[model samples]
Target: MARLYDYFLGGKDNFAADRAAAEKILEVAPELPAAARANRAFLGRAVRHLARNGITQFLDLGTGLPAPGNVHEVAQEVDPGARVVYVDHDPVVLVHARALLEGQGGTGVVHGDLREPEAILRDPGVLEAIDFGRPLGVLLGAVMHHIADSERPGEIVAALREAMAPGSFLVMSHGSSEARPAAVERCTEVYRSAGLPLTPRDRDEIGALFEGFELVDPGLVWLPQWRPDLSDMIDFAAAGPQASLGLCGVGVKR
Candidate 1:
């Protein structure tokens, strides 16, 4: 399936069929492009925060297309020896990742599904990139909604929590259903039509994913509001379907 990141970023990696569906989504909710950008920004900020706090190793799950400022780039910028493992099931992402890691020593990308956290934890490449004995950052940026309700996102989170060491942090964001039902409906339809159906939950529902972890300060607010780079969230608020949902946060595994 064509990953939504490729579709959203207007990348040519997506199929013509995917592009048509993406266009329909744009027609339905114009702020989608802005929303995608905001989500990426949130990922950068969260990763930097964790890295600055001494969490050098990272496991970026459900990773989409390797954009310019990716997790490893952001983390390594903080600590030169930072190690990161980018996990995704998309074949195109895997191919690009291998090309990008030609000579990189501490950073690499692996192919895996978030639904199989155990497999990811045991993957030889992932084990090489991360150390379970030390604090790490487990990133699920803008990816949880991809898991169907049948999979129980909370359960999956718990599994991830169990796999990481104490003091590990989970940084995540999801397409929310609150305060923007129409936009959510439109995007949901777009993904569904493409055979990659997604389910956006409300604040309460999304909050459940952090059930076993200790939420960071200012827990669960709008993406722009979560330690905003500037005080200009008004533009984020105006992005209709891509409206600011403060859908990002960090949680410590205890």
Candidate 2:
């Protein structure tokens, strides 16, 4: 999935098999690449927004294959010393992230799963870079949907919330079953046939994921609708025939 996502983002760090699989999926839903870009675009906006709002610590869950606007790069732009810990279960992702941060102080990567919040929280690398006593920006970008309902995603998220400080923020985006239903269904079918099960939740279900936190302004909205700037709007317009299938928001732990 990581490699496939890297392909979706037009990154070069993907294998031939990954490319072939992505091409096959694209044939089913031609707009998928556009939808994927929507998530990437939103991440830039969300991280930049969070950083400007005084978040110096970031815990990015499922950090996938690194791309142009990494969380550390965006956050560190606001404060050079901003600390970020990228967590991913994939060895390739971890290797790339680690190599990228070899000499980069205040940024690190950890091998962890989204389902095991406690393990992630206790990771020495995560602990060293982040101070839990202070506000932290925990990013769950487009990862929840891949988690099966049987994994108890809500409980997993709740555990992470419980560990956050009062002023901390939860920056997240999840696949929505409500938006572009046909596109969503087609994408889901292809992914499932590829042995990847998707569990896109409805607006209400996605909203419930942020239960313990107070949503920031323009709460739980489609990708294009969530705090988009003029450039973002222009980009979205250019990426025509796209589905705004991702529901995203920034929520404070207050």
Best-matching candidate per TM-score: 2
Model 2: residues with Cα > 4 Å off, grouped in runs: 238-242
The lDDT values for all models are 0.81, 0.87
Model 1 agreement with the true structure over 1-254: per-residue lDDT tens digits: 33556777656677777777778878877667677777778888889899999998999898887776888889889998999998989888898888887798788888898888889999999998799999999998878888889987888898888888999999988878884787778778878877885888888988889988889987887677677686436566555323753377789988
Error of 2 at 145 (Å): 0.4
RMSD of each: 2.0, 1.7
Model 2 error, position 94 (Å): 0.8
lDDT of 2 by residue, 1-254 (tens): 88898998788999998888899888866766777787888888998998898999999999999998999899889889899999999899999998998999889999998889999999998898899999999999999999989999999999999999999999899988876688778879889888876899998998999999999989988786778776656645754323657789889999
The true-structure Cα RMSD of candidate 1 reads 2.0
TM-score of 1: 0.93
